[model samples]
Target chain A: MAFAVHRPESMEAVIAALDGTASVAVSGGTLAIRAINEGKSFPLAIVSLRRAGLAGIAQDDGMIEIGAATPIAELVRPDLAFLDGVIASFGAPAVRNMATLGGNLFAPQPYGDFGVALLALDASLAIAGPSGKRRLPLSKFYETGLASNEIVTGIRFAPPAPGTWRWLKATRRALNSAAVIAVAAIIETDRSGTISAVRIALGGVDSHPVRSPVAEAGLLGQVLDSASATKAGEAAATFHPCFTDTYASAWYRRRVLPVFMRRALLGTPLETMP
Target chain B: MKSSYVSFTLNGEEKELLIEPGRRLVDVLREQCGATGTKNGCGQGSCGACTVHIDGVAMLSCLLPAELVDGSEIVTIEGVVRNRVLHVLQEAFLAQAATQCGFCTAGMIMAAKALLDCDPSPSRQAVIEALSGNVCRCTGYEPIIAAVLAAAATLAKRPAAAAAA
Candidate 1:
């Protein structure tokens, strides 16, 4: 049997409550309901983030800070409006509205939209526990996201100097959980239109979001040509596969990782375009 | 349970009521507030039938708690009309033949209205992205999209008239 709900005003009060026996923290409540229905686990108390008034995106000290309760629906609506493609990639607007960034970041399951973009952006995890507020690299937070006691408060990241961001996610049913793979790539080009800096992050093929150092190294300073892009794609297959659930096989995940990497890093070595 | 006082705006009216935190928004809208306009097609957030405008954005009422919106404004299907006259969106949906079974019509209109209000000259892709969350079993969606685009164009051309009405 579940207990009553709790909505705290400050981060301190929320942390104090977490020190109590135990309860489920919910922002949009989309994943909590999904977990209950999927028979994974049931939470006793639901701490809704609504009244906490933690919303919106702010640029602080050159870092992008997104509130814990910022729903995916709103995040998709960038002020510039050129990100409509990236935003549209998430499940129809309903899921986006009800699902949130913090919740998606902390969900134990691998089928999350931010898994790629946040990683590509090199985002950090903001935590508010009894120990007070602390920030962790996004990679470290993924290890603890499965823990019941840890609550992700927000994500912070400094924008890449100047680069192109490409996100590739494969959904079997179009609007369903990605079965095979997802990749987020950010690369900077020189005045000559040659590659200067590059970073690659892959998900759905690892227990945690993994940075493809091999892929990144292969693309850096290489003009990111097609032939070099192929090599970068091949290097991505080196990471371990996140083989859980019926999404896809570990082998299949390995094969698709390269394909996604190659496609995600277009306009390079292929010489097809200058 | 009785001490849970929720104060929020419903259909432009400030409201305060005693309810529990676990009480879902759909239950609150249909049972306590007597606003049956927000339908619950799926208790989960997948279906858009339970959609409502919370702070001028479409949200799945089923996934939210009534207590969560204690200070927020909620716009339901019934709230879209003016003195029994249909909203321009309603007329457009009708003029373009946008409904068949009608399960998704209300939510679709509300979502589209929010998009148009913010960006009156939304592209065809924008209209589709805005309404992608809504599902119409009756394949009458083509006309629905056309109507919203047409209505957006009309409203853009005559913003003063549309607002004055």
Candidate 2:
């Protein structure tokens, strides 16, 4: 089917363009155009966010707000060095120049590695629609997606403390390959080195990114070590059902999730983990 | 579907075309603009054979709609040469035998060109990361990496050579 592309200049214009029509918003086009080329049926119109005034990053009072249309490559700056590992583990440099954080939130399994990291960072989303503007936590947005005519405007989150955020992705190749099992965690400890808070997000094992409460619970009040990481990994493995895809079999993913979870927590290199 | 008129600067020349709905930039460059050097390999974003520069950043042409690039500056492999002379990257590739079937050479060179444009002296690891999206079916990646490093060296010696090309 043929579809006209709309390059609206403002959020209000974009929402109006999407109002009461069979239209979808596209940023970067990495996923949307790929679907179009694969003969996937789409709406009659595509709202392109390229010209929209929705791409930027702003920081205030220890909080960061990234416009929904900002390219993923923008996250690779020196100020945002904490995300270096996540961005590196993502698609290649060219792909990063086009893929956006907002679009990453909608990517399917094995493709939304960035979303998994955001979930661990406890990010929230700003959404605008016909009704008005509203805010939703990233975790809840995963369950109840946007309503008709609603669009994500931006993402807000606070940077995790230094040395607290950890990310790891096991892929067939070192770059440009989908993850076999991607893991992200934010583990904060007190002066005594006991885990005070934890948030764990896993990708590529399910249809969408998911948080592991069981795993988080296992690490609370415990020291971060190989044994605790193993316990947390064991706890996380049972919470979600693994999905098989071209990257790996269901059995293989399930068998390796615990290992990856442990490695992510302990900062173990993939080559030396085994 | 209604067709839209889109205009852009292609390889330093202003180009305007009537584009149909759902038309990709790669198709426009090859069919309408007569710049067939940009190959369409996977049509999906997986293969980087359709790599091109929009506003000086490397992007996959197959994934970009023509309408989105209106009023933008686009550079393809055909634009990399100057006055019948090859760019330093092209010369390095030739000297290193970096191409086999040559299907992926244009995209690979375009990607490398973007890298060199930003980082004049990129390490071998940086070259690999830049071209990770591109796939060379002949598996001639070692020579390609070597050529990019070599080109970087040549450009470093004669920085004006890159600007001239």
Candidate 1 chain B has its poorest 10 consecutive residues by lDDT at: B156-165
Total backbone clashes of model 2? 0
Scored by TM-score, the top model is 2
Cα shift from native, residue A170, model 1 (Å): 3.7
DockQ of each candidate relative to the true complex: 0.39, 0.80
The positional error of residue A69 in candidate 1, measured at the CA in angstroms, is 2.5
> Compared with the real two-chain complex, what DockQ does model 1 have?
0.39
The worst-scoring run of ten residues by lDDT in candidate 2 chain A lies at A233-242
lDDT by residue (A27-72, candidate 2, tens digit) is 9999988888888847789898877888999999999999999999
Instruction: Report the lDDT tens digits of candidate 2 across residue range B21-59.
Output: 979999999999889999999988887999999999999
- A183-223 in candidate 1: lDDT tens per residue? 78788888886788777887777766677788888888787
- Candidate 1 wrongly placed segments (more than 4 Å): A33-41, A73-85, A108-110, A146-148, A171-180, A188-197, A217-223, A242-256, A267-274, B1-3, B156-158
Q: Estimate each model's TM-score.
A: 0.85, 0.98
Candidate 2 Cα misplacement greater than 4 A, ranges: A269-272
